[model samples]
Target: MLIRLKELRLERGYSMTQAARKIFSHPDTYNRYEKGIREIPLDCLITLAKLYDCSLDYLAGVSDQPRKYGR
Candidate 1:
């Protein structure tokens, strides 16, 4: 999940600050999340999924598919 987050962010050309801004989070918090130093809140996770156009399952490492629908 942590790897997925960083990969997606890099794939989309989003710096940590930009990704944080997308989810209205502090840079430090976002950095912690990306580094697996802190657990991400549910709501924040949901927002990240939306921002990355992925599913919670994917972000949580329950699924390899990023998109829920896979359309």
Candidate 2:
């Protein structure tokens, strides 16, 4: 889960600031979340799931599958 966000962002060629903008977050805040220094909000997680085209379960680390719920 910690790796997923960075992985997805890099795969999409998004810098931290650019990824932050996608979720309406500050770059520092996003970095904190990425580094596990802060707990990410549910809304932000939902936004990231959508942005990465992945499922919350995957981000939550309970699943390895990255597929979204409804394609």
Candidate 3:
């Protein structure tokens, strides 16, 4: 889960600040979510899903198998 989020951020060349802005969240809060210091809320997850163009299952580490959204 941590690795995947970091991977996605790096793959997109997004700094924490930039990603936070894009997701309408504060950088510190987002950092906590990434660091597992705090549980990510469902709404936050949904925001990240849209921002990263990924499925919720992937972010939640529910599955590695990829599935495109709206398929």
lDDT of candidates 1 onward, in order:
0.95, 0.94, 0.83
The residue-by-residue lDDT of candidate 2 on 1-71, one tens digit each, is 88988999999999999999999999999999999999999999999999999999999898888997676
For residues 1-71, what per-residue lDDT tens digits would candidate 3 score against the true structure?
A: 77788788988999999998998889998898889898888998888878888888898888784354666
Ten contiguous residues minimizing lDDT sum, candidate 2: 62-71
Give the poorly placed runs of model 2, Cα more than 4 Å off: none
TM-score, cand. 2? 0.94
Candidate 2's C-alpha lDDT? 0.94
lDDT of 2 at 56: 95
Regions of candidate 1 where Cα sits further than 4 Å from its true position:
none
lDDT of 3: 0.83
Residue-level lDDT for 31 in candidate 1:
99
Best by TM-score: 1
Give the winner by TM-score: 1 or 3.
1
Candidate 3: residue 45 Cα off by (Å): 0.2
| Root-mean-square deviation of every model | 1.0, 0.9, 1.5
Q: Rate residue 55 of model 2 by lDDT.
A: 95
